[model samples]
Target chain A: MAEIARLAGVDTSTVSRALAGSPRVTKETRALIDKIVHETGYVVNETARHLRGGRANQILVIVSDIAAPFYSDVVQGIVETLAERGINVLLGVTLRQAKREAQLAKQLLTGVVDGIITVTGSIPKPVLSMPGFERKVLAISRAVPHEGVTCVTIDNCAATRQVMQHLHQRGHRRIVYIGGPNYSETYRDRRGAYADFMRENGLAELARMRATDSFNDDADSGFHIMKSILNEGDRPTAVFCATDELAIGAMAAARQADQIIPRDISFFGFDDLKLTPLMSPPLSTVSVPRFEMGRRGAEALFRQVYKDAPSSSKVVLDHRLILRDSVATIV
Target chain B: MAEIARLAGVDTSTVSRALAGSPRVTKETRALIDKIVHETGYVVNETARHLRGGRANQILVIVSDIAAPFYSDVVQGIVETLAERGINVLLGVTLRQAKREAQLAKQLLTGVVDGIITVTGSIPKPVLSMPGFERKVLAISRAVPHEGVTCVTIDNCAATRQVMQHLHQRGHRRIVYIGGPNYSETYRDRRGAYADFMRENGLAELARMRATDSFNDDADSGFHIMKSILNEGDRPTAVFCATDELAIGAMAAARQADQIIPRDISFFGFDDLKLTPLMSPPLSTVSVPRFEMGRRGAEALFRQVYKDAPSSSKVVLDHRLILRDSVATIV
Candidate 1:
């Protein structure tokens, strides 16, 4: 550190502040220090620095699947928001495995990361029980149901109710709900809301299908479920899917089965993915504030980690019902 | 460690091996040690362990964007492959910013990670010039052009030639090529191949369009570029895009202009994304083995970091041309 300071003609404290990305260090000084540090091949031992009680200034962002399009926008939001604050994000994809999630939780408790922002909707049980876990953990997209972990999520039930109301108003009585696994609180709420809306509207006899395999909820799963339903000749006027990927797959299956979209069956989906707008008839789905959820989640986590704020707050962002060409009125 | 071993009725080395996820540790003993560790709230300080000359067992995977969808499958492959070896993945998204890329490269040098696998194609100059960097760095998807960095990539030129030959065989004389930024060697190779093939086939007069804004190469960019071309009254018989996202967007623009796919204009794309098969016309694209690229990249990186092998080798994966409904047998 002193060598870098001498090379950059700055004090050792100034060199430290620059390396820490502190705002107190002017841009010119930071640049000089960075140049000197790079030129001198001075590798900062982050592990040693953290061992000496300095902040890691790094957070672990955990998600269920990295390939799932749903988490991408949210993660982009988190990475961008945290980057502006000079924090590095270390992403961990659990692939929906419980053991992997536990391993990651242990890593968090081991102090490699200063905090964790989990978009997987659930925190490991051991992590929740750890002392000070609340202060260093935040959840997004689904509520963790724990009292201490701050969550940034949308009202999935309300979003589902809006979809149901739209379909109901369009004179659709025979609507089939295809959902993902019920392990996710978000999926569970959506399914529950659909059931409630149907029962209250005197349309409770409609059949429902859910992804039996907990590990599969993507487009392929949606396609197979829709194909089987079509094969059984149980064609409803409309199909409501838990996700846009599922909806896309369902549409493909319907096409393969010689069913025309909107004319033969209307499709509604959740989590209005980017591909939704470019679909054949375009998908009528819920527009989730995924990026906002991530941004807000990171901000909330930062508050807890840096400001010593309470970690029990819940922030629900707004969602919109995007009615596109996929839904058609039926008399 | 001693306390845990005492509680689990095992030696300290057994506990250590179990914690390190060594193959020598029996599953039953590992489970017992894990249970005791969790029950006793024993936090394994990874930072301290690394400082004591132990392996970090973590690698950093860097990409340009997380939401682009192009990197998702590749990242999944890397994560799964590394996880099997008990190595954790720390993903860093640079968002295509050079400054951010430099920052991430600096992080790798700081000893927070054992090695780095960059999917972003180019490594920062400082990182490359650092002593012994060759033993700890790997590139994927695009060749780094640096001597010592092992690259796992596909023959973009060959893939483009296959697409071109397929189009030529289908009697499509007028084809347009739309590509991403030239900063990427992958895109550059694809573009170069298109030019060479067009000239070789005596079709040099065909027009070409590329995304001028280096940062924007997604669906929206494709849509705008295609829309502009349509507005200018340049209706090529076929359009080939560098990526599936771009092709999807181009198809949407054609649809908006009331152009029926394949019947009015044919469309072809590269990178057979999971969403490709679900598109309205089921886009015909080059199926680059993205997952295998990732898997191979991770394996090569492991060899360099663990086995102390040379890092100058290049692994070129195969690409397949998928025939789907989007392209027509035009006369």
Candidate 2:
């Protein structure tokens, strides 16, 4: 180790940490040290190194789906922030399967990753209650209510209210909400708020659809749901989706129906993904700071990995409604 | 080892490999064994285990960008197939940075990853010449022409030809090609094919744009490129891009310019990403089997990992032209 330190121009501890593959050693230092180690034909026993250092400098991030751009920006933020801190990320996309989530949670015990940041919440409680879970897990986007568990999420109810208020002010009396699977806390936040707002405003919530498939982020599934809604007549004057994919799918259906947006009906969505801005009418949406949330969420995980702190606080970020051409202000 | 195998209901080699975290052991068997090990408080020294097995079931995949759905679907396919084989994946997103690519390639020498599947080319040759590079490296999408190297790609020339054929038959005499960075092999394949097709038909190949910010899959950048092309006064009758993201961006630009697609100008793109179908005009594109390609590429990697076979086979998949509302035949 001392010899490697001298050869690589890094300290002895950095040589050890780099050998351990811990996030504490930056990639450049690791590369320089690895190059020297290879030239000298030095072999590193990673497990032993990890055991001594107690960190592999690697963190695990579990998402519902990677193909969804909604999650991609979040991942982009996490990777960028972690990389700067000499931490590497190992990502898993659960595809909304609780079994897969459990399987990944099980893999956590192997200790290849020092900490975890999970965007999906269906992770079983038994898995979460395991001795090592509480200290290492940080939930983002989907809030987990296990006391002392740190969660970073935007104000779901507040954002939902803003969408409702926007549509209400536009004079749309019949409004329907398209939500995700009922299992998600984020869904609960949005759906409960949607229902409560409707009740308070004397408008009935008649058109809420869930579980055509568990896929909440895919446009393919979203298209099917929207097609069903449009096919069944007596359609609501306005529709608000839990996420952008649903709204985009609904828009495609509307176009197929030859109904002009803002002329025939109003539509709104959440997340405000990059593609939403490029949609034909430029979707009206509630914008969540995806990249910023990801950066902050990863930073929270690092606080645990670096300072060894056990933080179980709930952090609520802000959201705002972005009114675009999709919403029809009924005159 | 024999006793552990009997207890885990598997063979001795399976026990050894599972203990070593080798892809050879199925995840279920590994999980069952891990559970048993934890229940029995059995201590397996992972370093010694790896030394005995001589392999890690983990393979590394290097991608150009993780945020793009084009790459995500490819990753999804690779991960799903590899996981079925009890293999774990370590993914790296280069974000089109040459320095980052160099860093990851350097880490390959540390031998933590058993094999590599690089979705992007531009890997430095000096790094490829290092010992242990040949058998374990497989290039997907972007072709690497190093001798005795395996590459998995769809028929780029055929796909490009089909796009040209579609536009030509649709009465588009003036067509523009929106290509990726000139350094990309896939770009070369598609661009060369486009130019050759035009030359063969005696159509002027005067509308090729490259190196405007060097962005390959960003709509924001694509919008700027398209705006410039539209502002140049002699806009092509049709615009074909290397990827859907570019097409979507061009559409946004066209919208801002108050020019309707296919009415004012036709549009076409490649990859037929999921978002393409939901776009305003339902983007016309060439459909490449992204998920299947990913699966086959990973499977090719596993054959080498499991059998230690020095396979350098070039496998080309098929692509088809998808006609959508974005293209309008002149009356």
lDDT of each: 0.86, 0.79
TM-score of each: 0.89, 0.87
For candidate 2, give the DockQ: 0.42
Give every collision pair in model 2.
Answer: A21-A56, A22-A56, A22-A57, A23-A57, A148-A312, B22-B57, B23-B57
Query: What DockQ values do the models have?
Result: 0.64, 0.42
lDDT of 1 by residue, A130-239 (tens): 77888898999977867778889889999999999999999998899988889888889989999999999988887465663676889988999999889877679999
- Give the interface RMSD of each candidate: 1.5, 2.7
Pick the DockQ winner: 1
| Model 2 chain A poorest 10 in a row by lDDT | A207-216
CAPRI-style grade of the A/B interface in model 1? medium
lDDT of 1 by residue, B1-331 (tens): 7899899999989998999899998899999999999889897677777788757778988888888788888888898889778777777888878888888777677777889998888887658767888779899998887787789998899999999999999998788888889988888899999999999999988746566366788888888888887887868899999999999999999998999998999999999999899887899999989889989999989989988888866889999999999988876
